[model samples]
Target: MRKLALSDEILLKVEKPARYIGNEVNSVMKDKEKVDIRFAMCFPDVYEIGMSHLGIQILYDMFNRREDVWCERVYSPWTDLDKIMREEKIPLFALESQDPIKEFDFLGITLQYEMCYTNILQILDLSQIPLFAKDRSEEDPIVIGGGPCAVNPEPIADFFDLFYVGEGETQYDALLEAYKENRRCGGSRKDFLQMAAKIEGIYVPQFYDAVYNEDGTLKSFVPNDPHAKEKIRRQVVVDMDKVSYPTKPVVPFIKVTQDRVVLEVMRGCIRGCRFCQAGMIYRPTREKNLETLKKYASEMLKSTGHEEISLSSLSSSDFSELKGIVTYLIDEFKGKGINISLPSLRIDAFSLDVMSKVQDIRKSSLTFAPEAGSQRMRNVINKGLTEEMILEGAGKAFEGGWNKVKLYFMLGLPTETEEDMKEIPRLADKVARRYYEIPKDKRNGKCQITFSTSFFIPKPFTPFQWAKMYTMDEYIHRAHVVNQEMKEQLNRKSLKYNWHEADVTVLEGVFARGDRRTSKVLLEAYRLGCLFDSWSEQFDNKKWMQAFENTGTDIAFYTMRERGKKELFPWDFIDAGVTKSFLYREWERAMRGEVTPNCREKCSACGAMCYEGGVCFEGKN
Candidate 1:
């Protein structure tokens, strides 16, 4: 049994003591003396939330499979425990070993969202590790970051020793081996960084310097080290079926956000939504083999004993074997009281039928992400959804007995106008009207429409990366416009309108497009006690604004200013399989309100074909 870092008195006082105790089923535990490398895989969030992430589970399983590596899980201490840890001077420890993270060989933090930036610093601070990579001693672990947010890592680059620019399954094995070799050779931290930089996906930020123009635009991003590659090409797993997945994922003692068996049906997206970063970064969509998926699903269900299972994908409806897979799960677990959850599915006749069979029509609400209000706005964003299709789908769903509808949209997309903003409420009214069109005898109950709109943040690697972001006031004004329009509707009593926080949206925009200089702002924000910025109640916009003021960093330079056609971006050094020329063409098409077909419909030659596999060549001769 591993001795815990927290005392019995402290454990008794915390809200969820099980979070710090590591005896959870499926959690890997090894003798540290027998391993060459001790990796602390950290998710800078609370235990329940972190354990729910599939990426960490995959990587944790992969790392532990190696004989030389012992991987352990670490999550940010909850606010209650954080206060006690700071006061007690107790170092942050891994759940498996109950050992300080400062003693680990590698401290890998997944940059899943922009809001988790401050929490990264909190993790380092609690571990007794230096916040800045440069300030760390040789005894400190090599802190690295990966995940979707790493596509634009310049904002937090100063904190990480290196960043893995793409999928974890691609080059992680080689990275670990290289680290072991370097350590055996008695290499210095700088020497190891140089060695790591030579790898395809590894980016050592210390070897690169950013030059800014007088106007605050990126003048140049040049590599200072000869060993560092000028362009860090993102690594991708071409074959989704070949990668290692955790069949025996850790089952937490406490309930989590997602407490079901999660089957990753596919990776990447075929639809090239201009505002979506995941669509761009994760190019050339790949699907897992149906048989392989079925096997994993069976094994995972048996191993974890989860009562429910969810299909995860960018677009679940786009999967070619979706029906087969869904049918398999439904038939296999029909009488077992197992529930099937399908998210991100397109609303159509086929999907509606499948959903009606799997779920209770009266209790379940159908969801549709039209993304934009009007057809023209939808075309601009390449959502490939039109008003006719939306209304038709809604009518079919209503006929199928789903009276409650949930509509999702983005407020400040590129080329958005006042008319487009108002169309959101109008579209919801149309859905409600369609629901009421059903005969009273056939209807489940009163038609209910829940409308949600989140402010758009321009992200790197997307067509909208060069687009301007709205101010907090502008976003709130837009939301207010929609709210006012919603109030005037005949179904106002049945309609519920909700908008995301404009303040948090603006901060996310700043970090999304921010350069290396933005690191100082992040550091200052962390110093001012900015942690868990993603949590609405914990986020303090005033402290973040003060951090910007203290750092002398102009927030507008990263968020409000639109980029020139030929201007260099801080993230341009990375080639995310998709070429810049293709992104520019897509941006031009978005400006012209021209919709591009999805990869399955036609090959747009977006340069993701460089991978020579996936949907890029799925239908090609």
Candidate 2:
């Protein structure tokens, strides 16, 4: 019933005045009396960014499909906006109808990354909700989170009531309907979550008691409820074609990370790159047919009038009928001013055919992630792509008239030798030489070569599960070594060589594969003003270090130590469908400099098979 006053002098001066506007053309509106459940979908960032997210758009549209449930969008204010809200004493509120967030029955946050952890607490405090799960009562909004980061929700476990592990389409609505009926019968929050936890893919952290050894390793996690299952399966949509998704996406007033009509053509990836968390998490690729995709893309263009459309997936090039999809899109939208952007094209020069669609208009940098420098190191990570393939791809990218090329490699992969890293610059030099080889008459643009590299982090449930992470000092030292080697190898300084901050990258590794005790450090860091840790301006690594010190937990305890093959990991309880032996075997193969083929060629026997009830891919039947 309450609404934010637009005439308020303080509200006028804040950044992005559109963020506070409760009404948008495409947003759903519901009568207060009409809905049984009021759900607030929160993204731990400002509205400008949240409104641009495809996941939030999909979930918002999906939930609004239900007549009985009302879902609206909410986001954390940027520092400037937060200042005005705090000064004006404005509590964090939903965008539509300006309803105080506390009024919602459920607060669902998308934990996309670890950087959003502090922002989560900020939203809770401003909503007049208790920060800790144990401190909240039946009257408070039940806070929940879901995303890839939910795989290790322990760091922020005390803040959320439960975590939805995987795909949300089927289970979210199903859970909401049950909650509405139970609330009508006067059920408590505990009763609601306990009942919801019974649904597949729902993980209630409160209902489990976690026991850790003195060494900080997890002893066991015992379930409190009788119906609470040990294996919290990920929710999946078998027939994505039949699923109700948003054909009309919300068009942002400002440009974002992706300024295009976004389409998730597939659910999972077939390539089992050992270090990739997404490949492991979103297992068993399920795709929507070309007919459905064409329909959706056409509908989105008609509704939003967007200039570009991105066919997004782990590997868009790997789409079985990718050539057909792009050809059809270009044909149907001819002269409409809408172009296509492909995220993952094989770096092979053979890919120039796909690159020709919008190559002349879009002059962005080319990206190739060979992962490791040498073939042996590449095999150890099961990257599968050969050196010849990378060179061939780079040659094509340069020959295709792209001005800048980015070569992506990792510094501290398992079994990486100085000799292995020495090959990285050698490869970059070859790519650079290829760029200069173009004929003088054929060259239409200036040539530039950019090489970027990152530190490797060992992840849980992957082949690297038992591997030790590179120490911060070691990672930095090796990065310097790469730069030195590049100079000696190339004898030319035209190339731009860069690496990410080792401190932030190291912390990310600690959080990525950490367990329950890490929650203490996360909480302490948050309490000490550590939100938006992903942003360069807001992140204070020293503060995080202090938090770890305050908690008496060493970073090496999580990152640097190699676990025994038989040891129980904190996340070992949650099965992603892949068995433990499979991960261990992959680790063993990596140690022996062996490479495993992809799921498309051979089944690695990871547990994602449980999603489709057969092999993960739709046609695998």
Candidate 3:
């Protein structure tokens, strides 16, 4: 029997002791002496949130399948456990083996969002590992980071020895095999990193140097080591059907954020929304085989016994075989009291009909993400949604017994005017008006139209990457404009408006487009106690401000500055399938308020054709 990392006394004190305990259902176990590599896969957040991530689940299942590799999971302890561990001087440990993380061979952290930056330091600090990669010894785990944030690894490059620069299913086997070979040859730590750098999609930050011009724009990023390539092309999986899927995912004792079985129907998006980073990075959308998905749905549900199943994708409706798979799922499990969820679907007759079958009409609300309020602003962002479409969708839902409607929009978009801001509430009012158009005898109760707006932040691999951001005051003013306009509507009682905190959005913007120079500010902020910035209760904007002031880092430089046409970005060295020229051309189109067609409608020559698969070669021989 394995021993517990925390004592009974300590476990009794924490909120969710099950989070620290190992041996959950479906968690793999192996003898330490039998496995050649003990990998510690981490999601740098609390257990509940980390357990909900699909990427971690997929990678965990993939890693544990190898006989020589025993992968264990670790999540950042909550604040209560964090304080106790610090006071007791206990090192962070993995859940499966109940062993200290410092004893592992690799510490793979997924960078899912910008707000989780400080939590990465928290994980390192508690594990007694060196916070910076340069200070680590051979005994310490080779700290690596991946996921969507890996596209812009420069902001946190100093802290990670290496970064796996794309889809984990592609090159992880090569990386692990190289590590095994290096160990068998008795190579030094740096020698192993040099070997790892030779593999595609692997980035060794220490081997590369970034030079900045006097104006702080990136001058050049060249690699010093011969093994390190000049450009690290993102690894992509051309054949989605061939990759392993996590059918038997581990079941947590506590309720997680996504407490259901998730079936990823596709890998990429056909809709080319200009402000979307995922759509740009994951090009040439690929859908899973319908037969394969039907098989996995049964297997996952059988394994985890989850009542609800959600179809995961950038755009679930865009899946070519969505109707077929959904029909199969409903037919296969309808009588067994199973629930099906479909998100990211466009609001239309077919979608409404499908959702009506799966979801309870009276209890559920319909959601529409117009992204921008006005048609002109929608064109600028390439939302491809019009006010007429939104109202028509809402009208259908209202007639179909969905009285509650949720609308999402973005504030501070590039070239957003006062008319655009006011259009947000006006659009909501229009939806409410459509709801009241129904006769009182046939309609549900009073209609509730809720609309939320989040400030736009320019992300790394999007057409908006070169766009400028507004100050905190400017953002709040825009939200207030929308709020004030809501009161003037005829059905103001049915309309509700809310906006996100400007401070956090501003900080996220800085981190989203930040360079290596922002690392000092991050270090200082973590030292001053800034963990879980995404959580409302724990976020301290005052501490962040002090960190910036102490580090002499100006936030405006990252957020408010306009980029020249030829200015090089920090992520220029990464070739993420989508050409920079294509992105720039899209940016030009966005500035002209010209709408570019999605992948299915017409090929825009975005340079993802090099893969020669997926949507790019959908119909061709």
The estimated TM-scores of all candidates read 0.98, 0.95, 0.98
Q: Which stretches of candidate 3 lie over 4 Å from their true place?
A: 610-621
- lDDT by residue (299-390, candidate 2, tens digit) is 98888878888888897766776777888987887567777888877665435776666556246777888888889988988888887887
Each model's lDDT: 0.91, 0.79, 0.91
Q: Tens digits of per-residue lDDT for model 3 on 1-621?
A: 789999999999999899999788889999989998989999999999999999999999999999989999999999999999999999999999999999999999999999999999999999999999999999999999999999999889999999999999999989999999999999989998999999999999999988999978889999999999999989888888999999999999999999999999988887789899999898778878999999999999999999999999999878889899989988999789999999999999999999999999889998899988899999999988878888898888888889999999999999899999999999889999998899998799999999999999999889899999998999999999999999999999999998999999999999999899999999999999999999989999999999999999998899999787899899989988788888899999999999997777777778774323344452211
Q: After superposition, how far is residue 458 of candidate 2 from its true place, in Å?
A: 2.3
| Global Cα RMSD, each model | 1.7, 2.4, 1.6
Off by over 4 Å in 1: 610-621
Per-residue error for 251 in candidate 3, Å, reads 0.5
Model 1 residue 114 lDDT score: 92
Candidate 1 residue-wise lDDT, 1-621, digit = tens: 678888899999999999999989899989899999999999999998999999999999999999999999999998999999999899999999899999999999999999999999999999999998999888999999999999889999999999999999989999998988898999998888999999999999999999988987889999999999999988888788888999999999999999999999988888899999998888778889999999999999999989999999999998889999999999999679889999999999999989987897889999999988989999999999889999999999999988899999999998899999989999999999888888899988788999999999999999888899988999999999999999998878889999999999999999888888888998999889899999999999999999999989887777888888999999999988788888899999999999998877777878774323244342212
- Per-candidate total of colliding backbone pairs: 0, 7, 0
Model 3 pairs in collision:
none
